[model samples]
Target: MLSEKSEQFLMSLRLELLKRGKKEDEIEEVVDELRDHLHEAEQRGENVDDVTGGSVNHYIKTISKEMAFDKRIIKMVIGALFAIVAFFLIPRMVSGQLDLSMYRIIFYGLLTFVLLPLELWVLIEMLKKYGNSKKGYIAPILVALGGFLIILAGEFLLREYDGESVIVMEASTIFWLGVILSVVFILVCLYFYQWFYIGVLVYLVLPDLFANTMTDAAPGSKEYINVSTAITLILTVLALVGALAFYARYKKNS
Candidate 1:
């Protein structure tokens, strides 16, 4: 059995390679080879630092440089983008119509395509460096919190700006579009065997739908607002817990 430190090193190495877009099969092959080597070294009473020459990050960089990028990762990236779009759209569709403003378009575009990916890259790099320690998580958590604040500020600013409508689809069109996108999202999740995202979709998209369709409260009433807020909070908590559990299982399996 590999030591915990050796296992963490291997997991981090795999994650870095994946982030770098290395071919999945090739990455698995290299990881298996290293696992065997590490197993042998551990049996001989050597540590992970000894195997990696005291610098796992440098070792990972060297390995990443030697690996070729996977073209298929582009498809995965596109699918991820689609999922994000669907995630945002479903709630609006459920609320009755799809009224998109120019400001909302520009803001969400920059956020989803640019800032989000940049934040993910930063988090991944941070994890590669300090994933094994409790203190290492602090910086990443703070960075994530900062990103959340930026998003909240942007959303607040967006609501205040009465920008021109880029497009406004009626209820019927929006409903059909939501259905199609939801189907596509489900298919993609099923194809990837990532059921956690399905849970996310349910928690995120279904809450508004349920509040609007099932509840008797008037839309602008305090009761309606309270109920919506409560449902959203409960679902958000469930989603967070589910995501953490899923990540834990994924890490353990990996």
Candidate 2:
């Protein structure tokens, strides 16, 4: 049991680190170390201030400065690719039809390139905030929200220019080809230990599987789409659970 003063100091440190943009992993490590030090100090009946040199905020800043940034190139690359796919291929799959234009493609391509990195950073931070303690709800919601936003962006882009949104009777074979490629991409990410990419791909692939099958976007077709959407959500939840379990097992063996 930590003393009240020591717990307060630790919480302050956590908040300071967050404000400094320190990664969650780094903050947790720092807190763990401080906790051990505080435990020893408490056992000795020493003041917590003495352990922190009587300056908690200053120590927090110092630790923040010392922590290295986690700038993984692979993560950035995967995020960028996802942005392109989400904003481009995914909307087509969801609608099962589109009369796309070059200008729309270029516009969304630029938007995705600009925004995806920042979004991925937030996603990673969220994952760190919510550790993998077998909870699947949050992960699916986050993944689905990101994909849904991108799909909406694509729809808006298509809608802006008239005569560019067409209805088709079937999903093109090209779209299925893209699905196969996505599965390959997911496998590759998994091989390289990019678990976040897997989650994103799961959202992309599973929802798409259901959406691709529903070709009727006419009146009274909402029921089919609604059913597909529900199935997609359930699949997303299952994927998260399986992912967490796989991750735990892999870590144990590793």
lDDT (0 to 1) per candidate: 0.78, 0.65
Which residue pairs of candidate 1 clash? none
Highest-scoring model, TM-score: 1
lDDT of 1 by residue, 1-254 (tens): 88878877887888878887889999998899999989999999888887787665688766776788999999878878877777777867765556688788887888889988998888877776777778566868877898899989998887788487777667657756766676777787998887867876777766556666677665566766677788889988876897899899999999
Q: Candidate 2's residue-wise lDDT over 1-254, tens digit each?
A: 98867776776677556545567788899999999999998999997888897665668656656886555535656665774565456435544444456666665665566555556556555544443433323864776587668757867756776454333445565466556666777776778777776666566556555655654453126765675678677987897899899999999999
Candidate 1 lDDT at 162 equals 49
Model 2 lDDT, full chain set = 0.65
Candidate 2 deviant stretches above 4 angstroms: 8-29, 43-57, 64-67, 73-91, 98-174, 214-220, 223-227, 233-254
Worst 10 residues of 2 by lDDT: 128-137
lDDT of 1 at 243: 82
